[model samples]
Target: MDRARKDMIVKEILYWKDNRMLPEHYCDYLLALYTEGNRPKDKARKAKGFYFLNIILLLLIPLSLLFIYFTELSFILQMGLLIFFTITGVSLAIYFTNKGIAPQLPLAVSALILLLISVEMASHFFPHHNTALYGALMLNCLLWIAAAWKFRQHYFGISGLVGLIIIVISIFI
Candidate 1:
């Protein structure tokens, strides 16, 4: 196309991006193609990070199904597996963030769930230590808040805020 048409297309893509009609990454790719000068930002890093993440996800799906079906495992064993998964997920999420890829939401969510599960297990195992349980939960919430602030993760911030509110309300009651 001619210069004017190409410019018009670029403007349209920008409009879509600003209005959230198109994904920001998609818009960036189109813009790069049209402009034929500037490169798309973090393209290689995102691609590599997501490629490995997708492979891991594909493998995890069936493994997770099997895990869910296996209810006969001992509680300690289950908790151990969950802790491993949580650590792995958090590490991958950190790697993605450091590499400028969008950190995988599922991984973060899984890590949070596993953490809560492990805490619940600990509370059960130490039945006489309600105060310790509360302390641990509160510490987890505060750490989430600090991490959210440091990483600018709105979901973490929101979850941490809700958890803090719940902890405070529980203390009053």
Candidate 2:
């Protein structure tokens, strides 16, 4: 085919991919075939950036835990740091989900951060109240289920259900 015809076909395929009119894999295969295996440079770079950001976000989970447990920071400062982490994780999750990119990394990171902060806050504020800690856990599971429903992510739903089951088992035991 001519250069102009190939370009038009590529643009149409991209439009279908972006609009979800065609399955992503099909669009990708067509693009590759038409482009002779050379994909867009910018898209590859953008994907790499997202993957790097996701890795950084994942690393923050462990760092946050260490900061909370090992630091001499005041309660207020710890809480501030937790809040900042939660906000960043949640914002990235929402952005990835909306952009039809790989959202699971950010979603998992956000869920973990929220779980940590909720448990920490509950235990700190209600040291003698086991019920409060359990409540915090239950609430987080519910939020995970809600997020799954909203984001159409089955893994979150499965994880939420498993969490609820574990909590119930522990409560009864």
Candidate 3:
């Protein structure tokens, strides 16, 4: 084949790999056959950076929990920190999902952070209202179920259903 044709094929294969239009192994094999084993170097570097960023984002989950439980910061400051962490987690999740990377960890972390934020804010604002707290929990569970449907994740749905059951039991007993 001509050089132009080969280059076009390689670019197409790269696009397939990046967007997950084809399985990664298939894309790799095609790229290797087309490029004669000279794959792009920058992809490896970018992958390393993404891996590092993923680790940092994962670490932020635990750090946010610690900040919420251990610190004595003012309520506004705590809320600000939580919002920042939640936004970062959610943004990373969306980016990873679009790039065909493993997005489950970031998505799960964001959901957990959101749950914490909702519960904490509800309890803080309605310290004496058990009904309000239950409402907040129920709302979070519904959000999880909605997210599960949107994302096609069974675990999220199961967890939300279980949460609803538990909340109902608590309310009765």
Candidate 4:
């Protein structure tokens, strides 16, 4: 096909896509075929390993839950696992996000949950140190804020801000 004609067809296909006039897969195929040589290579194509890691991390969620629910593990062991998973999830989130994937949201969320679990565990272990407990809470909030700043993800930043506010309120009360 002539370049001009191909460009026109590509535009028409994109119009159809925007209007949902054609099936998504068909539109995608046409777009890829027509724009293959013209478009720059997508940045996402470079991070194949990050994509694979994300998939593995997702698959582990159910298994992790099963281990927590079905096993008669001791409290210390469970806390240890939660801490390990939290660190893993947060690290993966930071790593993948720097490489250009937005799919790390779940990992970030899992890390946030693990931080909460860690806080709960700490409270149980050292019941008398209110100052230390608040400090730990602030540290978790800072981690969220740091991740949010690094990834440019507003949700994490907002949540961290809210958490900080709550901590302040708790201290005053």
Candidate 5:
């Protein structure tokens, strides 16, 4: 309402947030206020959280999921995929953990595209070894499931379905 009222409100929020005594909803409220210039510090903290969360989601989650899809150790074909995801995920996490880095969405998407290619490459590697192929496919399905849950991305949901189909087809083919 007035400057004094606003200052008091802001101070109370800071006290609650700093003390960790506030509910997550309160943090959300602060985040909204901060985003709207209601409070500067809270906005900064919210932005920091988002920056790191992007790292975790765009890079971390996928990397962590695909890490299990190891095909060849020597050629490093599948391990390559694992490494690709791990590196990008870790890099993003590092890049934005402390401060916002004005993340390049294109780079992240490009890395993801490569990661997808790696999965296809891995699948092709063990065509004869149905056991390995199917097991890896199952892992892929679960990974997509997690992705779908976290991101609500239709691609993930579809990818998960494809993984299931691939696993089933491998048994017959």
Candidate 6:
């Protein structure tokens, strides 16, 4: 590819990642066959779960903003969140490269938690912005349900219940 075309492709990939793109067969591949090198290692170990969870968080970008909207968080708390996400994101990326992600990846788990909390806050506190609110609610709900069904209780089944509640309320609201 020409220099310009190559640059465009690189930019597209970056955009897709920023948007948290998930593959269709991502869940399906969890069980079909095991890749020998896919397991986690140690301090150098990389958890695949954390890796993919980070991707899913891309979709949560809007929802995270919703969190900032409703919650009466202190400036420190907000800054803390920013730092925590950045650190965890970078750590998980390293793990992804090292194949240290043995079983459950921490990033995926964190995303599920973040999604649930954000959805709940949006549902309970934010009373307006039907479009943005509903979109976050529905998206989080579906993702939660899918994650629960695929990973089972291992990924925190509580999120499934939360998603169900959000979906019902979304329908009514």
Best by lDDT: 2
- Whole-model lDDT per candidate: 0.70, 0.89, 0.88, 0.73, 0.59, 0.53
Per-residue lDDT over 1-173 for candidate 1, one digit per residue giving the tens place of the 0 to 100 score: 89899979988997787567988899888998998956346457647867877577545544544554567777677667666666666777776666466775645555465546647666768878877777778777877777678877777778878988998899889
C-alpha lDDT (0 to 100) for residue 99 of candidate 4: 42
lDDT of 6 by residue, 1-173 (tens): 36566455544544443344644254224312232224232333233545556566564555456545667886457546744654564465455545434324444545554565555556556667566566776676666567567646344457656766866776787
Ranking by lDDT: 2, 3, 4, 1, 5, 6
Cα TM-score per model: 0.55, 0.75, 0.76, 0.53, 0.38, 0.34
For model 2, the stretches where C-alpha displacement exceeds 4 angstroms are 1-40
Which pairs of residues have clashing backbones in candidate 2?
none
Q: 107-153, model 4: which lDDT tens digit per residue?
A: 56575556657566668788888887888888888887897887677
Find the candidate with the highest TM-score and give its number: 3
* Comparing 3 and 5 on TM-score, the stronger one: 3
* TM-score of predicted structure 5: 0.38
Question: On a 0 to 100 scale, what is the lDDT of residue 111 in model 3?
Answer: 86
Supply candidate 1's per-residue lDDT for 172: 84
- Give a tens-digit lDDT track for model 5, residues 42-111: 5777678776666555664454445444423444555565566656654654555334354344234534
Q: Alpha carbon lDDT of residue 147, candidate 1?
A: 68
TM-score leaderboard ranking: 3, 2, 1, 4, 5, 6
Model 5: clashing residue pairs?
none
